[model samples]
Target: MSALLPLPRLPLTALAVAALLGAAAGVWPGAGIASAQGTAPTTQPSRLPTAPAQSRGTAEQASVDGVVEAVRQTVLAAQVPGAVVALQVKAGDRVKAGQLLLRLDARAAEQTAAAGAAQVRAARAAQDAATREFERQKQLFDKAYISQAALDRAEAQYKTAQAEAAAQLASAGAARTQSDFYLVRAPYDGVIAEVGVVLGDMAMPGKPLVTVYDPTALRVSAAVPQTLAAKLPADAKVQAELAGAAARITPVRTQLLPTVDPATHSQTLRLDLPPGTTAVPGQFARAWLPVAGSGDARVLVPAQAVVRRAELTAVYVAGADGKPLLRQVRLGRTEGAQVEVLSGLTAGEQVVLDPQAAARIR
Candidate 1:
């Protein structure tokens, strides 16, 4: 009651103005009133896109390629040098074994063979006369009409005549064989790949007259490095592709040439091809020789799952943490669509199909 004596009274408008100013100050920056009445901020979880389902299969280490080769090939040449009289077969002609391919001027050989035959006949006549004389002498000796020395001399003459006749017969047979050589015959059933002699061409010994090859017995030959030669097995399986046809072949033999080429450092490998296939010689081919003792249980995947980068090969493998990782892998042989994983992955592990996209993302 004592403090009320100094009090000053204010108008109603001034009191109302003071109240509005206080409210404005409360809504300005640094004031905590607006936050108390506002809603809380919210967050949403991120979602990654899912990959599509793809089909996959297991793979094994295998080698595959095609080779071109002739089944059998040989050069036909004249055994005796002479002028070519008749050419029966031409290039690209199919011929049977023992079919006449060419003929030489056989008049000379025929004359020689005829002379030898006449000599044999004359020798036989002389042998018959000597035998008759020996028989007559033997009868005389048995009756004591001729001396033992005389009978012995006749027997010696008869033996000499017989030996002469046998020699003549052998000479005649040789002459006949030489005459037959004038007619060149095919050594085997084959196609004439080349003709080196014309009708009037002079054929000489060791000179190629014709080249023949068998299409059915064709084989593929390849030069393998020395390092790889040791690993090749005698029974290893092989396949060849030629002229749009694929052939399955077996390793029948492996011939390591005694000499290795200084430049290539490789040896030749000859493979026996199956019958009824058409492979030609002088055609290039790619071959795979399986390394011996290199086969074992391995983790394999489809070949399509692997991608080649610069100087490296990579595969996409799904990790247990639900993320795919790009892995560099060493590869081995390829069997069909499957490939061997030499390193980087394990068995029963999941690998990404269409690894290109996965690799790109990584």
Candidate 2:
């Protein structure tokens, strides 16, 4: 025989409420209806807004990054090998044309010059003696005291001596010119940007000793790609300014180099800055060059629409059915907040402005 177990009794109000909740769960198909009336349902986020792809103009302008440089920048090098004896100017010092900047040990040059001078003197003395002898020979020939052959020899000696004197004089001048190489002078009026050698430092021929730049004249040099360079007009109006500057600068002139760099596939463009610009060499700058035509269709998209994943770059484009799809695109130069799409995208397509927001759509 099994022992009889006693059942615990519940309160009437609690029993009635539990019965009602059970009935409601059974009546509803899933937890959705019950949660909608009692508890809150987890809400899904909405997709981000999409922007239409814009067609770039046939003639669009591209921005160029470059460096500011002086019109006349020279690195003076040693023409003769010698030890530096004097360095008159330091970095940032103002200089004038023909100003002495440095001096090298010229003892050997001086000695050589002195020897040449002495040879000139000796040659002159010999020439004078020869002249006197020739005159005496002439007088003797007139008196019939000297043979015709003796007079002829005396005349030949004088002529030979005169030639020797002239040769020596030229040699002396050449030696002096070599001696002048020991002295370094400023080739133009400018500021000394750098001093490469110090006093007592040995300088070899063709080694740089000093660098100078004319601060008044400034220019910006930039390398432009071959494709865009071809579209530039003959007298394209260009605007340039210092990087992160607050002022706009009107270029004095613009010049495109005739040669192209094959390795970079770019051509050099030089823009002359107007007078009184605070631009200096080695500073960063930018120039806006007008493009005449691309000769092909291109898409332009907002910069934020592009998504980057390591080496992969893509954008979320809206399909024909209005569904978001990922697209890989090749990018060209950037202008302001928009980027030129070279391929993998076409005009009239829509792209999600925020890629992260579009990820939740699926």
Candidate 3:
């Protein structure tokens, strides 16, 4: 079964970005883009052919698939091996921090801890005896009843016992801590998304027992092409269309992870959703990101000027002899009435705005 909640009417930005991901994007299929700057092919307005849009605008918008994720989540894991004796919470249960979520049979751990305690007591008794002996030896040395060598031996024995006692105390404390790990507790206030172990199940150290997430702290994670990510403005405006939400929502903050994926050539973009927004971890979302940069400027043409055929994207260009010649061109993003041309037809070239009209003239 699909784990994701079904998304609503697909966002337009998602489709646009997904379609124009590669180097040679054929999104427009011979669509007209703005003509190059400083060059205009003089053509009559009523003529069958016209120049591409005269102005090259720079602002661009892109969209990509985003997934809702919790900003804070934890998968509780067992720190000591034991049999699962009790499970206090199941999936979807809300819990507070430090709340007991599961209990493990700690009979073996209890024995180990008791053994550690006995060792500590034994060490302390030995240390006390050593102390008394050293005191007695010091007094004998002072009164000349014992030799200096005998006093020094007693002092060394006392110090050795003191060290042993300290070591045993630390060992006992560690044993007690390990025993406490047999009782699993929630790390934070969150909903239990998963319960990995059942009563009577044997849990090994490092095995996950429960998954919890804070439902209120959510963000949208999307992967954007490196080219688009590099061009994103410092204060770029971001908007999101969350699954099941009535309208688009703005992110409270935007962040871009520095590392880029080697395989996909994309970087992860995270947008923190505002508080009180209805969203769940793993839900689908679409984010519109603004792409801004400067270059030689884009060539845009009217969408109606595009001529598409099987694997063919071209336009009828006015030849030197005033005849129509089909010219192939690569395309880019669409802006309202016009699309960007990545290559092929350039400035000073007369492109037929209406392919049908040019066909009749030919």
Candidate 4:
């Protein structure tokens, strides 16, 4: 049988084993395989990593939420009860001081005024005649052409007529003045924020006809908690954003209302706004009230360093062994990109920039 085998054939398994060994020893299997396996390793220089440190001397700023309000708001009411015959202004209309806003039915008043004027003219003529007659009677009595009794009668008549004329004149003047109340004019320069009267509508005395507001005098009114109320300064600076316009206003005054709201447990605070502002009433706003820093300094970290989980907020602080250690933090004010750390971390301690990575490591 050995003679019939002619030559000892090398097995297919032996060939494959030799090829694999050759490829492993840096020998080429083919052009593609050789390129993939025999190529020299790339030499990429390693970069020195830079660590993020806590920013220093960052001034902490406080923030509070509030609403925009107009400091000067007026409710225009009809002085006399009458039918609203005309309306010269509508809501959102700008008006000047003393500008006529509306008109009431003054036809009857005008007629009464005209009749009063005529009566006043007649009374004046009668009073002049009475004065002349009294003088003539006095002269005739001095010359003994008239009896004392007759002269006294004429003087009494003259005096009575004079008194009547004087009363009539005052009544006429009053009627004329009353006629002028038909026209309603604006008391000051402002914008009409509301209109409650229309043409032919009956307007009553003391009923609001329109609501006007001076946009230049705007403010933010907020109810601050009592615990934080003491920290608010009289001259505190404020910034308000309303209807896409932001304004910088100073606190002209701060008033704590006598009673606290039962539901909110907060006291009302009225903030005087700056002039030439255009914030509308009932618009929500945010405020910042500055509090003095404690004498002992504290460190600040980036905003991303803090993580909120469930009901707790925490940060990952690096230990001496370069491993992240989870620590709860008491956060304070946020100044731009940095946040004030009130507790949990020390001044020189390092906090991880990526909290998720630190959490996974922990």
Winning candidate number (TM-score): 4
Predicted candidate 1 versus true structure: per-residue lDDT over 48-161, tens digit per residue: 233322223332223433356675689988899889989998888999999999999989889999999999999999999999999999999999999999999999999999
TM-score of each: 0.60, 0.64, 0.61, 0.65
Looking at model 2, report the run of 10 residues with the lowest lDDT sum: 39-48
Model 4 ranges with Cα > 4 A deviation: 1-4, 7-64, 230-248, 254-265, 290-335, 338-362
What is the per-residue lDDT of model 2 for residues 163-235, given as tens digits with 9 covering 90 to 100? 9999999999999999999999999999999999988899999999999999889999999989888888888
Clashing pairs in 4: 66-285
Model 4 agreement with the true structure over 214-250: per-residue lDDT tens digits: 8887778777777666666666554443445545466
- Total backbone clashes of candidate 4, pairs 3 or more residues apart or in separate chains: 1
Clashes of each: 5, 0, 6, 1
Provide the overall lDDT of each model, using Cα atoms, as 2-decimal numbers: 0.74, 0.88, 0.84, 0.76
Name model 3 segments beyond 4 Å from true.
Answer: 1-60, 292-362
Candidate 2: regions farther than 4 A off = 1-60, 292-362
Candidate 4 local accuracy as lDDT?
0.76
lDDT of 1 at 111: 97
* Candidate topping lDDT: 2
- For every candidate, C-alpha RMSD to the true structure in Å: 12.8, 7.4, 24.9, 7.5
Against the true structure, candidate 2 reaches a TM-score of: 0.64
